[model samples]
Structure formats: C-alpha cells, structure tokens
Target: MADDRKVALDAALKKIEKNFGKGSIMKLGEKADQKISTIPSGSLALDVA
Candidate 1:
C-alpha cells in the first residue's frame, strides 16, 4: 500500500537523478525556502513551465 508507493517514488527519484544528474529533483519539504536559489533557463516559457 503506502510502503509500495514510497518504494516506487524513491526508485523514480533515483532514476531522475541518474538521467538528469544529482540535485535535479527535490522531495516535499526537502528544500528550505530560505535556501532556495533560482536561475533563468534562457526561455521564459521553459522557466515558467
């Protein structure tokens, strides 16, 4: 049930990090608002999306 979902979520996160490189994904509450950083992706649409 919930455990199964957690396992799947963790696996998915790992896969994303593997493909996109580490620090590309963040779990809920894993990031602190005060420490957040932003940079332009060069396209407004891409950045917004």
Candidate 2:
C-alpha cells in the first residue's frame, strides 16, 4: 500500500545519501515552496530607483 511504498522510498533515499553525501538530492516541491527573503542592496541609487 502507500505506507509500504513510502517506507521503500525512504530506504532508497537514505542509501543514496549515505553513498553520495547529504543534499545530493532535493525534493522539488519542498524547495519550490520555500520563501526567499530579500535584503537591500545597500546602494542609495539602487534603493531609490
């Protein structure tokens, strides 16, 4: 069932990370949904314009 599939997928992901190192694979939805905070460029002209 879905639970079994999820278990298998988790095992595969762990194996991949163990061999390739962490953050070698990223889940798109998780990355895409993240909010990026913007900061000022610190230039007067750029900030005004």
CA lDDT scores, all candidates in order: 0.87, 0.81
Model 2, 1-49: lDDT tens per residue?
9999999999999999899987777666655445657678999888666
Best by TM-score: 1
Q: Give the TM-score of candidate 1.
A: 0.59
Q: What is the lDDT of residue 30 in candidate 1?
A: 83
* lDDT string, candidate 1, 1-49, tens digits: 9999999999999999999987788877786335657999999999998
Q: How many backbone clashes does candidate 2 have?
A: 0
Question: By how many angstroms RMSD does model 2 differ from the true structure?
Answer: 6.3
Give TM-scores for every candidate, taking all chains together and pairing residue i with residue i: 0.59, 0.58
